[model samples]
Target: MSNKILIVDEDSKIRKVARVYLEKEGYDVLSAENGVRALKEVCESEISLILIDVKIFTMNWIEACLKIRKNNVIPIIFMFNEIENINAVQVLPSVMGDYIKKPFNSEELIEIVKLRIKRYKISPSYQKLDKINIEIGSLTINRDTRQVFIANNTVRLTQKEFDILELLASNKGIVFSIEKIYEKIWGDVFFESDNTVMVHIRKIREKIEEEPENPRYIRTVWGVGYRI
Candidate 1:
């Protein structure tokens, strides 16, 4: 069966919007107006992933996520307004698969959903590329294990972060404009001021560079893009 996605929110409009776009991407979309209905759907359906609002009308999002996670391994993506403590949500009982800030554009939402679901279905062993490793400065990348190291320390990175690092490191010294990088990695047209790629780049630098403000490996080209 095609992967099924559940969108749980009290607002019918949000559910409809999410469902329409998700369905367009060839996913089987299901939605619940409240946590009770959401949990019921989880019990009855083979849900592949869940997109939940932080504030549901009937229950707290973290509570609902914790309840569902007690039994299911389905990936959960939190949808929250900018006002919420987004970073704090990461420490909830169950792992939050991902989060999207409020007022997200359709393309951005879909991209995040696609990447998260892709990671969910693919095993780590299979996600790794064949026998390729790169070493630059203090950074070491092992494509076989999809891991990065700075000196003797292993630097933890999200899939997207690893992908970005791999791209820049593999083609060392090649300047990649933000738009080009987005298109190559995301397989989509880049949009203006989409900070998604930029955010990941910053995070990757913090993990790999000794000093992010004065990055040694990943260098910025001012008005252009980034290179290593």
Candidate 2:
């Protein structure tokens, strides 16, 4: 299946250019000029990735990214006019998947898209399971139906959250720096703040950990990074 992508930017010229290039690469593209339309498209369509402008029609990309993280795991790449305003290490803990300074090379953008899709394929969380049952302590992850159960109660997780959990679980004892984790999960070796990863981890912990303040599965590595 051709991967579908959603592009959100207020500038029609930018959208047209992006659409042209992406279409030439054989991707089915959808676009929105505002956050409202973007949200609608995301909720109503089967989009694999999203390329969003950081500033779009009264919508803050960070907040939009966070909202998107609440429901979908689709890789989100933020395009900004200035790289200096973004904190690559600190923001990695939030909803940032990748960061592209404006005036991005068309070829580079395509490569990034391909890389993100490739990484998503190998993600432990997105792995298909033959069985419906799997256990993680009191939490049960249902691969067949895409559901997580804790103490017989269901815990809903966004696609990104599940992906992060799967990565950490797949390498239980291995420590992953925020940068490493961002690269692995986001397919972007160059990213914004590390906090983007931290924020997502916190969200995941809130859902699965008995106490997010003192997590059991996902652990912080002080000045380094995180581990499970």
Best by TM-score: 2
> Tens-digit lDDT track for model 1 on 1-228?
457789988778888888888888888888998788887777655567889887762336457667766644578888887655565664565656678876677898889888877776674432332235576765678776676767535688999899999999888889999999999889998989798889999998898887899999999999999999
Model 1 TM-score, 2 decimals: 0.49
lDDT of 2 by residue, 1-228 (tens): 357789999889888888988999988899999888998777655567899876752435456667777654678887778755455433446576787777777898899999997886676544542133455566566554566656555688998787787777667788988898888888887465447888899899988888999988889999888887
Q: Stretches of candidate 2 above 4 Å error?
A: 57-64, 87-92, 128-228
Q: What is the lDDT of residue 114 in candidate 1?
A: 86
- True lDDT of residue 225, candidate 2: 84
- Candidate 1 regions with alpha-carbon error over 4 angstroms: 57-64, 85-93, 124-228
**Model 1: worst 10 consecutive residues (lDDT sum):** 123-132
The per-model lDDT (C-alpha) reads 0.77, 0.75
Each prediction's TM-score against the native?
0.49, 0.52
**What TM-score does model 2 achieve against the real structure?**
0.52
